[model samples]
Target: MTPANSDGCSPDFPDEALAAELDELRQLLDGTDKPACAEEGEGLVIMRLCSGLTLQEWEGLGARRDLRDWMALPITANPFPYLTRIQQTLKELVFLSEHDPLTKLHNRGAFERILSAELIRSSRSGQPLALVLLDLDNFKTVNDTYGHPCGDRVLETMGALLAAEKRTYDYAARVGGEEFALILPGVGMVRAEGIVERLIESARTLRVVCDGVDTPLCVTLSAGIACTKGKVAIGWEKLYAMADEALYAAKAAGKDRVRCAPIADLTGTPEKTLVRADEKRFLFTGTTKG
Candidate 1:
């Protein structure tokens, strides 16, 4: 399947590449090799040939032969060039539908879908799932001061950082301008906080070399974390809202820090706790450069 670019579209296929694939398929189908017994969808039709076979012999065995018998034939070959290409094209389309072209991460729509599906699985398995929302600190200042191109460079750097940090099962996505989301299945609050701490350190160390700049540009990230264990009967929407609240708290306290939403706020209880956690709970690891 062709992977989608940031714009959410499959890359244009080159004429030369298509032609080369066609040529290779033609070579495989050339009459030198015996064609394997071919069956179309649902066994509704089959294609096979046995040279000089009597009508009676053909009728007795029917038109189809076992795959083992076809494999035993010295001249037998697989012939389905069109089918192979179609399958590949379909796969490419699926990839384009789900992936973001720019950062090569799952797009928002795909992320939401996966979040719902994962929540269902978590509910069934009684496993914890956590979500982290990240926003770049001073992103607008970078854009206004250095220009949008430089800002884009910083965002691209962030995308790479998030991609590298993602585990095999994690779902990471670019959900908005200068904002990213990470879905951590089978992970609880403490481990998720540790992950965010490492990310904060990485953000502090990240540098982008903008055009015509003697010094590299550095930016920090502010994030909020929310987990399934936060509240009973909470779904993705509540979790996300709680994460967003925590994110605002991070921004209010200071940029370049991580905050986690507690159960009271997530559940929308009358006694919602607005008190921010201590600095240690902010999950800051290194000095954040303004």
Candidate 2:
């Protein structure tokens, strides 16, 4: 007594019901009747009906994306197609707003937003946050001698290196031309020192060569770090100012070196390690291992 078709897998409607459906379909195709517009999920069903006269044909291409892609084309006029594309475009726009187009890293605004959030989280949890600012040493000379194109390659290499090497929770951003920032949440001074040292060492060896050039170009980094001392503290502005001060200190000492914001002002009393491309320097505790 259950409704079933000859296939026995689908409910079979009475002849009258089938005839009524066929009449409605015929009227729709003839443009004598029009169905109300609907959303994408339902729109897919309607599209299948429009594309195929037979159930077998609809089943073949029903789930494929060619239909949606075809619908978004310039020649298509239906409004339903715009629904899917609108969603996709909005996501792309959000990403572009936060990311730098050249290096494909988070831009300065995005970095500040992330840093502000992390400071709140660090203050609440009493975990340390390390902020590092790195500037390319002798960057003007590199650009003047090698040209801007080669300089661009150097920045790209640094961005890519930071993206690949930083911890998963850390955030990397291209804050300015030849300038980059790293935000490490839940990381303290000593650990921050090791992390920054490793990053600079890795960057030191990257070979950026211009076309028709045999020698690899040298573009080194001078870094400064400021950390919240395993305590509840730091407004975003204060944190950035401290890091900037540390960065300039590194520049004044010599190029291609790492410097930390004075611990007396911040937090933690651990021996600080400084990484210089040439000597492998350390401060406070003073040990030269390299």
The C-alpha RMSD of each candidate to the native structure, in angstroms, is 17.5, 16.2
Candidate 2 accuracy as TM-score: 0.64
Q: Estimate, for each residue in 145-257, the C-alpha lDDT of model 2 and write its tens digit.
A: 88888888888888999999988889999999889999998788899999999988888888897865679986678999988854545688888888899999999998788
Model 1: lDDT of residue 111: 86
lDDT of 2: 0.72
Local distance difference test, per candidate? 0.71, 0.72
Question: Can you write out model 1's per-residue Cα lDDT over 1-290, one digit (the tens) per residue?
Answer: 11223332223444344335434545666644443433332322222323333223322332232111111111233435434544654676688789887777888999888888887787666678899999999889989998988888888889999999989889899888889999999888899999998999999998799997779988799999988753334567877888899999999998899999875234554222343344334556443332
Residue 27, candidate 2: alpha-carbon lDDT: 65
Looking at model 2, report the run of 10 residues with the lowest lDDT sum. 44-53
**TM-score list, all predictions:** 0.63, 0.64
Error of 2 at 209 (Å): 2.0
